[model samples]
Target: MATYPQEITLKVFVNKTKNCVDFVESDLDFVDVLLSFLTLRASLKCECGGDINTSVSYDLNRDDVNYEEFRGVFIKGAKFVVTDALCISLVEDLISTLNKCVNGDRNHMEVRLVKIKREQVLRILKRSLISDTPLTDVLLQNGEGITPKFSDSLAGKKVEKKVIDKEKKVCKLNMVLTRNKVLYAVASQDFVDLIFSFLTFPLGSLKKHLGSRFRMGCLNNLYGSAERLRSSGYMTAGCAERLLNPKLAPYFNCKNQVIGVEEEKEDLYYTCNGFCKLTALYFSCKSHGYSPYHESNQVTLVDPKSQLGGTISSHGSYCQKLMYMVTDELVVTPLSLESVVSFHNEIADPIKTAELSVTEAEILDVLAVALTSNTALTDAFLGTTVGVFTSVDVKGE
Candidate 1:
């Protein structure tokens, strides 16, 4: 429950020898902001900082936080110095340039304070993704430029229309193809619900589902190390589990999360210290009995959506019974004929279309593509190198 200021200050340690940022020192609030990257739903064709460690604990009562103590995970008064080794390359060039000109103390290390405002945090969150560096690639000296260039071999490729007649029908993606690339795809509610659920996924859950091969900077190493530590009995109870396979916060899960990320359930109950009346109305506490009138002892926990004495609506996250248009870049909007026509106009005369029925496996593939590539639809369907779902029943139109 830390209240973040409009601007948060970070103390960065620059190593002159390595020409990179050794780590960053900041309060818990800064870490909170950085952790928001895992919840991004859309893919932004931009670069960002780096993946951060998400295992730190926070105090619920802000007053109990010892600002004076220099803790192992987070330092207090002098700013929590976190050795965020991941994605240091993104800032190595800036550090290298500064190392040459800036004169510093004897330790071959320079300390600099960088102030970031809420505006910057919002901007970063708007464009942030889970696997890639959170810092923009433009900051690095040899950054892999944004929007990976499509290979020439993909040009003039065609995807023909296909239909699958099965006893159990699932959601389908009507993909518009121009040559080798997917111009866009028309997704139904079920598929769109799955995509929207990505925004609610925790970093740990994503890493767990994607597996260790899921490379996004140094996150794989960090997650792997945590797993090893946990099995070795080196980590605190529930620390590694929370960091490695975190469940979505309450009420974050949608109806069709084929990625298998689970949601956290709240089942805490509270009653009065002294029990007298209202014991018959509710379950009696084993120790203190039940006292609904005792306001001081009773703790009420209710779902925010169902506080008014009704169950949560069964409706999924997105609008119901609507078709959505999803671009290769993961831009999702309402499907319309005008937009479809405009997309068709962009493609040359030799345009082809494909209809694909996506099950859980294909949905998982889409999840993988969304995390790693900008051209999610194209890569999921047409990329020869990547594993494409070929066994799906396809009827020639």
Candidate 2:
């Protein structure tokens, strides 16, 4: 069930009458539950059907489902059909709600303590950096994983014919960006959290951010080919297309000094929509002008949603409301330390910071071991989240 829905929520109906709403874990498969959540058309089956062409509706947001409630909903929605984009959107929203709940909810939950060795954390960090795979994939592949375990696969479904995937599997990261410069990077929501985990110290301290500025040295594996990534909604339709050709590029300003915005009626494609924005936040920078530091260019980790449907500009506390700009949670530049200070000064809030230095140190260690020994990165949660008294620690970022 969605922990909290901003507006419309998943609803259910039986014979033109609203039944129950939101997520209810019944014997029914989760997907079937989602389909049943919708109000069925009149022609759909119903026990108390007054007419075959009528409909019923149902939605509820009371609290967690009880076993009894779960059983009933399961039986009722057993034969429900109709799975479409709406189901996908609801699922996406539900994912967000779960994140908020997991982060904030503590009621009726037991307290637990977890202690993780620095070595375990460092191992995972190094492996991802060296292999160019997302950290999650590194952790999941188990024992020197050579292939990415993160990409999804629809098993049993034959992929439709494709000109791109069928051709030589070109690693887009191999294309160096000289004539084409990146205006922005869009990461999905899960990626955002992963990047945050990397940027922030695992152990808690008073510090809010890791580091204000550092150079992005990894882009080879992270940059999904433009078209493939856009379909996921991290960016607009033309984003990858425009970048492929500099003359038509819409991301940058005329002088190529700044980025432009992709506007919609109310929603802006400035930042990522959600899901992978954080992961997308880290770019595999292959642009010609890519630099560790640019005196004139300033970078800030942007939370696109913070703007309240506003544009993104390189100004303000979180950042000035420029056009709808997509950004990851952190930004780095080769700009001088003074430039880094100036970049923070523009912001209105004093936030938690993470330092890239710690990550860099891990990278060094991992590279040393990898060169001589095929040491791969691996990590695991040392404790559970269900607890009343929870203690968190950091190994010093």
Candidate 3:
């Protein structure tokens, strides 16, 4: 019985014309050796500066590769220059030659193992290497890196390893962070918003140039968790606790005492793409294979007790708001409140009318200190001084 020849299409792009040429796969595939086709001396004129042809074959043991000679990378399935016409002829001839040779003979054909160009190799002595260069730049005199023939297998692996992995977690740095390099700022609305904006560019930057490369978290644990993340190529910035001024404590208690556990984490994912700073931490912690929080601080914040005493109460409770603008802005019209609650129950449960004032200078002083001081906003920023869970959990994932 006789069998019909099987056909498979192989696509190749002509550099000069930016057009594709398809050939039968078996006709074009390198069966025994590539030199068989190089013997044809097909000169392909590419848009690149020099000629592209696969005539230069380097032997690993005998050949000393001057960096100039080894133009492209040595990855599998890497392409070299062959003229459009030459490539066409090789395919035709190869098919014809295969028609005569025993089918199993090609499999048994042996050649010295020259090199695996694209691999992770370690040198016993010394070698300098640049990665992911295109064949056009290598074989062709001035071959551009953008030749369609370049197969970016290494590039794909790089992204999978470095970029994609980073996006999946909050990074704990391999390097140590010092106090001087540590910046602890209260989670002002601007900073909270910055965290939100950072999330918008989880895998990439929203605007080119310098993209956001940090995570967001409540200012609750800046000294511990957030700092670790920031030092290790990650930023987990968020709101600080309360602005602990004796005069402002009562008003702050009224403004920020509504924060609860669920709302604390909801901010991270409210507008984010299903990821939060904790989500990143969750991944990073999981990867470490040990619970970093297992031996960590107790996860709770008692109610914020005012130094002035009895005048303020609401510790252990989450802040009602991340930050309240206690500083005043001048208003021409007298504002009327539908309802106002005073700290003193004896004065009345609700005050029908309310009056408030803060000078521009006072406003600037309070906000500047709150936004700048690392310690002022801790109570309000993070209700739990530490964290709730001992470590990251998949939660059904």
- Lowest summed-lDDT stretch of 10 residues in model 3? 120-129
**What tens digits encode model 1's per-residue C-alpha lDDT throughout 51-126?**
2223223322244556445232311132333343332212332455445545553477777766665545543343
Over 4 Å off in model 3, which ranges? 1-179, 211-320, 324-397
lDDT of 3 at 191: 27
CA lDDT, candidate 2, residue 235: 34
Collision count of model 2: 65
Query: Pairs clashing in candidate 1?
Result: 47-136, 48-134, 48-135, 48-136, 49-134, 49-135, 157-179
Off by over 4 Å in 1: 1-18, 22-84, 87-170, 228-234, 267-317, 384-397
lDDT of 3 by residue, 121-223 (tens): 1110001011122222322222223422212222112111113322222111111011111112222332233222221111111111111111111111112
Candidate 2's displacement at residue 367, Å, is 26
Candidate 2 wrong stretches, greater than 4 Å: 1-29, 32-148, 151-334, 337-397
lDDT of each: 0.53, 0.25, 0.22
Instruction: State residue 215's C-alpha deviation in candidate 2, in Å.
Output: 25
After the best TM-score superposition of candidate 1, give how far the Cα of residue 182 lies from its true spot, in angstroms.
0.6
Candidate 3: clashing residue pairs, number: 32
- The residue-by-residue lDDT of candidate 2 on 23-100, one tens digit each, is 222122222222221221111112212221111222233245452334322122221111211122223335665456
